[model samples]
Target: MALVPASARTWLWHEHAAVPLTDAPPVVTHLAWPPHSRSRPLAALVRTAARLAAPDTAPTP
Candidate 1:
């Protein structure tokens, strides 16, 4: 498990070449929950897992 500070969310995508990190491309499927909420971290993990599961499908935007 990892902790992602809200401010560093954008940086995570840029620094990690392997992960799908793009605000415009909608890397995550569903992100209705507030980012500061506890569930936001889970959502991030889900997106990360999805990216890792299928790297080819994720666009590098």
Candidate 2:
């Protein structure tokens, strides 16, 4: 299974909204990862989950 959900792509898109990620609305983002990604750390994942779960406004970029 993908390490992160398909929606996880939105976090990255919010980071780079200046350019369009796809030719569509709702601003969807898609990503692919290895079955086992060693580069990502557990702590980072936890932090990212917390941020994503918490309420926030759209990115200002």
Against the reference, the lDDT scores of all candidates come to: 0.56, 0.49
lDDT of 2 by residue, 1-61 (tens): 2344355666665544334345445534333457676655754664565566526632322
lDDT for 19 in candidate 1 is 34
TM-score, every prediction: 0.27, 0.27
Write one digit per residue (lDDT tens) for candidate 1, span 1-61.
3544455666665545333345644334543555667776676876776676567766453
Stretches of model 1 off by over 4 angstroms after superposition: 1-38, 55-61
Worst 10 residues of 1 by lDDT: 17-26
Clashes (backbone N, CA, C under 3 Å), per candidate, total: 0, 0
Q: Please report how far candidate 2 places residue 26 from its true position, in Å.
A: 1.2
